[model samples]
Target chain A: MITQRAANIAFNILVIVAAVFFALEAETFQTSGLLASTGLPSKFFPQLMLAFIGLCSVIVIGAYVFRGFAGTDKGASVFEDGGAARRGLLVLAVAVACYLVWSLWSFIPMLILIGPACALAMGVRSPWMYVSLLVMSGIVYLVFTQLLNVQLT
Target chain B: MFAGFDVVAQSIGQLAEPITLALLVGGIVLGLIIGVLPGLGPPIAIALALPFTFHLEPIAAIILLLGIYSAAIYGGSISAIAVGIPGTGAAIATVQDGNKMFKAGKGGEALGLSLTGSIIGGLFSVICLAFIAPILATVAIKFGPREFLAISVFGLVVVVRVAGESLSKGLLVGALGIFLTTWGLDELNGTERYTFGSYHLYEGIPLVPFLVGVFAVSEVLIGAERALQKLDFDQTSLTVKLPGWGKLMKMKDVLFRSSALGTVIGIIPGEGAAVAAFFAYSEAKRRSKTPEKFGTGHDEGIVAPETANNATVGGALVPTLTLGVPGSPAAAVLLGAFLIHGLAPGPKLFAERPDMMYAIFIGLFIINILMMVIGLMAIRFAAKLIQVPTTFIVPTVLLLSFVGIFSVSHSFFNVGVLLGAGILGYVVRKLGYSIAPLSIGFVLGPILENSLRQSLVIADGSVGEFFNTPIGLGIYAALALTIFGGPLAGWVKNKMFQRAEDA
Candidate 1:
């Protein structure tokens, strides 16, 4: 029963916290000689942007809290059902996994992961889909490496 | 400008070659196939073709891509007319009347009107582009960093306002996009903002991979959610009958007005063919003597949106060619193509390479003309394209995105950036936030940052100086009007109704 409003409020708060942390971290950017003499240091823009983002986040959270005052009720569930939630999370996990594979192994591993992972996330239970995906991955590999001569690590 | 005519003539002469003609035909056919299928449009079509363009000369490449761009917009209407489903977002408005006409057994008439409207609109806009672009390019040559900054801000804000129902959500996504671009090394200074000690981030995120990721990959993920559904439609009645000369002549006012409207809207940053189509549709309905017949399978319904949408192609190129500011997302991809060709699209481009400008102008005209012949042949088989399953499309799109992104930079890091961006785009889209503002913001980010920093230096710490330039102030004023005028007018109307109720 958690509505979009509640989710948005939580999201905004998290963003605000992140912005504050970044703003604080930006202080280590070092203000020296000419940079310090420029009236604002290198860190100025980042800090300013963070502050603005934080302010917007606060406003968004306030609006969510005072929803009725804005003449609209909090509407729609954040997730339709458990199935949707699971599928959405699975897709996110697959994306993250692909990123990790690319980072740790190589581009070939990540390329191999993309199709099967996507097909699985979409609930394609057929064995043929996997075969088709493998064929697709191979074609992509040939096209990039052979034809275009891309250095795919 | 008169001396430039010789270059135009030479470009025109080259376009007459058979190989160039073949590429145009091939590109249009390919574009139509991609566009008629659900979830693919001009940007995807162009992105897919980008790698292939690397092998061709500038004229051939531009001609082929331009063919794809024009035909794709036209192709979208095929599915909208044949089935209730829209092939592209631009064709969504076309469905209301186009599908209804098909249901009422006037499928041929509906399609004919759409085709004719699209061709007329395309032709009109190309002529407009030919006449207006060079003049605008001449003037744009005077633009400085301050002017460029104003233009970028105007584009980004307009995109955000038009992108979604929630202004705050749009702004947040837009800011997030710009913030992501701020990663890697700063250009003016050697300071690394958010590279996190990686040499891969030194050149910033590669444009091709990021766009392909955000648009193509994100779409594939979202397609997964609706993959289980089967689409059914009556395809037996699908036919196209080009409208007679008399009918088209009778509807000249609607055609001209819609073309102008589409072109003007296209000139504005971020507003694309789809928005122009819908706006033209509504305007046509508003001006019609029988407004009741509008959503009930009227020929005017097909004409208005079709004409406006196709006309926007030429309109979109104006800003992209002149100022390096892409007028639409597809144009953003096209800008990347320009960069890949080692051609920077800006004021200096006109001075440095007049032949390229002439080639684009002549090539675009040829594309529009060729679109008619190719579109007719292609539309016959276009409806069959929709039968392509989501399963096939998803993997193919993913593969294309993978190859396309890699082809641009030949770097795994770029591919990683693409995947990361794709996930972000998919998540945000599922949460009902639009990717338009985000994409536009990313494209405009460096321009905005560089311009702002330079302006600050020029202004010497005075906020008022930002508003001092006459052209800059005028642009800001127009932007303010566009943003606030709608709400202000609505408020006035509401107040008037209240007073009337009291009376």
Candidate 2:
């Protein structure tokens, strides 16, 4: 249960740091020919955006640090409860894992694992629900492979 | 205006094909199902359907997605009425009175009014879209880089203003979206900016994967968080009962007003269906003879939001088809559909593909009519649809997104991008930031950067020259009004109130 004040302070601080990195990286951009001497350089737009983002991040950080809240909600938590946080993060991990499996092995193994992984992440107890999800995933696999002619490798 | 009658006729005739007809009906059914599911909405529906359209004809693909777009908004109200839970953000306004009406045992009547109002509103917006898009396209053909820059800024700023409570947060995400677009090769100089030695980064981020991640995958994670939340709705009361013409005639004013408001709001970039629904609902309540009756099982309350939300489908498409700037997130996904067919949206599309253009306009009309028929049959099963446990929805959608993106390009880089974007969207959304600005900004980023750079080149060092064009000036003036008008008027009213107190 992360409060809005704490979350904003941390998020804004991270944003400011990232903005600085991107701004510095923009300095290394190289352009050649007549375009180099044109109206603006390639780094100009990205740097401008980085500056704007950094400024906004500062404003957000200031409001949270000084005012103790971002806006209307006085002390709202980012997640409703620890259960929600656990579920959200676990499902996200499952998604990433599925992607990795697809990248390393093939689409079939990833497809088979994705449904059960998410169900486990969510703490589902029903075996029937698990079977239905697997069937649904199988149907999706069949449709893409046979009907749409997509090579799933 | 009817100069393209032959093309329009041919396009309409093409809809007679069995495959195209089946796809159209299937899209509506899918849209309805998605819309009835509380967490999924039109953009995700469109994004999930986008990859499937890769092998189909452009006309067929566009029609199928259009069917989904139109019906999804209308489908949102079924849940709002039956279960007091808005299936989509657009149905938020309907929950108060709609659920009240359901609780009062007039569930059939409430469902009927919403269905009828949605159809009328949808048809009205389609008519407006068909008429207005070509005229706007004709005018937009003359726009230069500066003019586009003005419109893009206006779009981003307006989205920021409406998206969230914190202006800084919205602006931060908006700027971040634009910043992310600067990756890969610079479009102007072809200089590698942040490709990081990967050939995959050369195209920047792929639009379909990124959009699908932002909409569908983000929703999946969010839905996973609320997976334990269960729905208990009355299936017995789910039947729709169409109101007699006399009853509809009595509420004709509400129907027309909400439809018009939804359309105008839809035409404004990034305003979206939810905003339009809320605006129309408040306006209807404001103008009602019995304002006290609102939120107490009032028919007007149900009618206003349903109509307005459905109407926004057509309204949002106006800018999307004609100017290439999507009016809503759903339209942003729709733009992906356009690009997949190797067709660029904007004024050129209308001129180059008049048949496809007419096909979209005609297809949307057919979808709306078909929605009424399908909606009548589907409303009875909507309670069951709404009861779909999010535990099941989370994995299926994630898999769809993964396989869908992979099948599109056979690139694992895209699947990686999708996963990364989903995580980014999830974290930002959890931190109480609206993804609308992030998404709209991303969609507008290329246009914004290209236009600004091109405009700067055209003006050289003359900053004043950016405002020289009439269209650009007009757009800037509009932007000024949008930003300053509210605060300025509030200040004036406050001064008058103080003066009154002194007197």
Index of the highest-lDDT prediction: 2
Candidate 1 lDDT over residue span A1-153, tens digit each: 557677777778888888887777776664444545553355666676667667767766777787621113347665666665665567667766876787688888888888888778878888998888889888888877797677676
Candidate 2 residue-wise lDDT, B318-423, digit = tens: 9898889989989989998889789999998888888888888888888989999999998787658888899989998999898888888888999898888888
Chain B TM-scores, listed for every candidate in order, come to 0.96, 0.98
**Pairs of residues clashing in candidate 2:** none
lDDT of 1 at B282: 97
Q: Residue B143 error for model 2, in Å?
A: 0.3
lDDT of each: 0.80, 0.90
**Strongest candidate by TM-score:** 2
Clashes of each: 0, 0
Off by over 4 Å in 2: B497-503
Candidate 2 residue-wise lDDT at B172: 93
Model 1 segments more than 4 A misplaced: A30-41, A68-74, A78-92, A95-117, A125-131, A150-153, B13-19, B490-503
- Write candidate 1's Cα lDDT for B1-503 as tens digits: 53356777787777777878888888888888878888788888897888778778877887788888888888899889888787777898899899999999888888889888988898888888778877888888887778888899899888888888777777877777776676666666656666667899877877777777888778877766666566766777766788899999988989999999999988898888889999999999999999999989988888999999999999989999888898988888888888878888886787887777777777777777777776666676778778766866776787677667666666767878888888878867766678988888788888887778788888887788866788888889999999999999999999999999999
> Which candidate wins on DockQ?
2
